[model samples]
Target: MSDQKDILKNLKTSSIDRRLSIAKASFLAGTRWATSNATSFFSSEKDKEKKRKQVLREQARYLVSEIGKLKGSIVKIGQMMALYGEHFLPREVTEELNTLNNQTIALDWDSIYPHLKNELGSKILDLEIDPNPIGTASLAQVHRAKRKSDNLDIVLKIQYPGVANAIDSDMNLFKQMLKLTHLLPQTREFDQWFEEVREMMHREVDYHLEAQTTQRFAHYLKDDSRYVVPTVIDDYCSSQVLCMTFESGISVNSPDVLTLSQERRNLIGEAALEIAVNELFVWGEMQTDPNFGNYLVRLAEKSDEQDQIVLLDFGAIRQFDKDLLSVAHDLILAGYDHDLDKMVLAMRGYSFFEQIPANIKPDMAKVFLIATEPFSSLKNNPDIPEGIMDEEDRYDWKLSHLHNRVMQRASKSMASRYFSIPPKEFMFISRKFIGAYTFMTVIDAKTNLRNMITRLN
Candidate 1:
């Protein structure tokens, strides 16, 4: 097995053609396995189905391994699919793909120093950089460092050499895969979504923008005690290199977090929900990337404050259409009132429906209402009553069976003829919403989310 893996290692070339070649080989191997397994020699129909699933699981695992080896924008796409593709792809595929979120390998320090030297010049020599990165991702790796002048601990985010340059090629390759995989409906809407993603990817590679965005968020969230946005150090930053005050905490989903008392977990979850609400409704500007790695759970050492959630990575900031908030408010109110007609009108106002069929409109309304059901300020729903929630407020992830319902509704929604992409204006914010919701679920957060939003309004 080691020898077979070594063969794969030898072929881990960064060249686009070589990477695709390896992918093609894996696909063919999966095909062969499926063909060989489909035989009359199987004892029963159940055995055949079991064999097919086993083959699928194997192929999915193999595909994940190969994609991790071919890191770049491809890995970024894989991460998105892992997070958002639950509604689009099979459960087995999504389960395997989600692993990519943490599987990216960083370029070694020997291969990375030159880029740092070029970006920071002699200042690089003055700073003490740790040999190993604390975090590695699709576009960059982060190393802990300290200044010679004051010994102030900081983090250096260094972008890979060709990641920015490879955006176009990577998108082209990803588009080709989409056409072949049928992972999404091949329509103008899908194409538009792809283009939006392409533009966002290109924007993300700009460290300058990330630095600026980080600084801006530091200001917006400075007064908020529950959240921490790292302060960017201007003298140490450049187009390809970002330097900021180092924040120490456990990963949001780390095993360490799961050990926290349920009360603490509820606090963290409430903080997270509030952060999402303020970003969407108050600021109207948001850091759209909600990768689990982007948040750190830090304990406060001060006298007054408790724990704080540290926000990291600001490259994907977006300004949403403020009017959409009003529309969303109306939709929720209508849903709470059980006024399907008003809810449909509000959804149409948000351009959620283009040519949606009449038969599905009622179901669609039901879907919308159920989604906002947790937000009901009405005491009728004992689970989430209207009021300032106590520390005991908790939202159960499994109670509503949201995962299965979302999967079903999304499939039906995409099947609609008039269902194009969601309003382009929400292309990215919707991703943020889904990601934040998932995070809340992961933490087993108990917060009246609607009340959180209500307090702000």
Candidate 2:
């Protein structure tokens, strides 16, 4: 349990309370910014620019701090913007917003228990519920529970009361706050991304949709021994509470995982990457939030048993359109072939790529080639660092430094106005891959990516 001061007794769910909180914060931030600007008028140009950036950072910090105190959908909105708003939000603002923690102070059981009882009614008696949450996020908290009838271990995801009802008002309030701070660009792209965030917020709170998604993924992966998805307990589920079997495992970055054998680690990494690939090529839907907490590694107790990955949290699943998936597929295939022309041609299917100048296309292609280096044959991709690929063609993910190289290439190629925010769909795909890459890197896993990509092909 958190200190009483740290635990939230209740979220300020009323529209008036939320609006007033945001309005005060925005007004304060905006006033500070205007005052700073006015004061900098007499300074030298260099000092003025320096002071302006400093003031912007201060204002952003103040706004985020205020948002943090709200402890609900608005904070989530800020965090989502931080992840996807790089193209539209000012650097200072996004940098500050990124500091908003996903794991906020848990609502006290006194507050959450009543909501749970109301949602589950007499059915709540079927389980022994833990008052302390095992996990707490902006939208909900999860508690470990056990069915009294058979002592089956399970978990209950309890949504914060009124969070779903407050999404629209909170989103609008956040936008107004951003506008007041003058930190967001008023562009069509910003509006589109904002709506995307709004839709995602709504989806995150929809227990029915999440329940179906969890079941769908569980069904799809039923035959795959390498993964585990929790089975939803329908009798205990409601609009505010989702109940599922509690799959137990250690964290993906746990010391136990780090101590695993090389082959074991490689298998784990391969399974992780294969899921991301399968989501794009086969499933057409993805669990887009790649936060490390979303995954847990269940080690095998028997020598003959394979280790399994416990995939948790199906709230952020994204379904891609067929056309977008086709283009993305082509891009990866083109990268595998190391064909610049093919890569450039694949880029044309997306509007974001069309914005890239002709001369920059080859540079962007090179970045894609670097990104897919592990998926390519040594003969096709000459840029792979020497010794990073073993004789068996397994790519050393830890030694490859792949993300840094791709980022360097992108920075060099897309400098200035030529840089564009990718289509939101692409952003989700890329973020998923990045998450997979980070997982592999953390585990120091080496596997034959060529084989994995070939299987997908």
Candidate 3:
């Protein structure tokens, strides 16, 4: 068996190199397409508009097909770019890359059975499982199962069989393409982003790492009955198989949240924010993916409006850099207090940029004010008198317009834009904040947001 693994390792290495070579070739083809399209459009070449569009269409087809042919880190990066949408790439490219996220083929039992047997030994059939998968994502999927000993029902997350090798090959290709196309940020300090992502994705493919991350997160929030994270099943866990006690909660995506008591919905929103703020400002650890699927509202054991929030998935956790996080805390506080200079100094310091033009400095403060949703709703009007937050009236046009302007400027800025990708540790923290606020807005729960802001002080 050891000899067979060694042989497979050799083949895996060779296959990876071949995959990288193909990826580089694909990137080159993309570059050619972009160059031709640009030249045709810019130089007034024959059938310029039509040919340029056609060139892009062809590039889209090739990239979509080629990216799907690979998996692991490269495809994952492509999907992130797609999700980022118009912020990072053209709509066409984003649309093409989005398909790569869930397109990888699942492993059949022929391949997975060996590992199942290895995990549970010859007693596999004694345990219960639905051979069909319950949920499938990029690197893993869950199966509904019951234990033989006590009939303990649980969710078993099986890591895809070959994703580790695939991720290694694909990310190397992604790194190569980043260097070639300069699609990644141009800063030297954050050059380690890809390497860090590689390390994380490697950890992600290993069930032990995910298990440990989940355990630590659970422990952190253990005292708070208001929130929940899945518990790890150490006895049943393996390098590729993770089993956790099952959870049954529904996501809050439906408009029917309107029917949910406004007070109850507000509690959900407030709890999420409390968790997010505490995590980012105090604890430093956060689960960053902002997918709505990460959250579920479970009705309380004894009551209706009194329910617990269920958190699922922890693969993409990021820790905050202490200095950066501290600056963020100070900046948000300063912005709320309406101290322009203080906010400006904090913003520039928080930005890690020493100098900015005098003209843009004031706009910067205004920008930050508008970006902080709750405070921006006050709109710098001291005489308007603060009012209680209304759950249904939570959406702020000011915040949305402000974000749109900021995103537009960021999308256009080739220079300062790269400086803004927060250290990866802060990704989940930001996501948590965004998700919490959005949820709150949906519920229209009025709170003394100022009181919440002052807690940082």
lDDT of each: 0.69, 0.88, 0.62
- Estimate TM-scores for all models: 0.81, 0.95, 0.78
Separate clash counts for every candidate = 4, 0, 8
* Model 3 TM: 0.78
Off by over 4 Å in 2: 354-360, 414-418
- Candidate 3 segments whose C-alpha is farther than 4 A from its true place: 1-58, 69-73, 83-91, 102-105, 120-126, 175-192, 255-258, 300-305, 348-351, 355-360, 375-402, 405-432, 435-448
Clashing pairs for model 2 are: none
Cα-based lDDT at residue 180, candidate 3 = 49
- What are the per-residue Cα lDDT tens digits for candidate 3 across 349-415? 5444345665666565655554564542354434222342233334332234334554565444443
lDDT of 1: 0.69
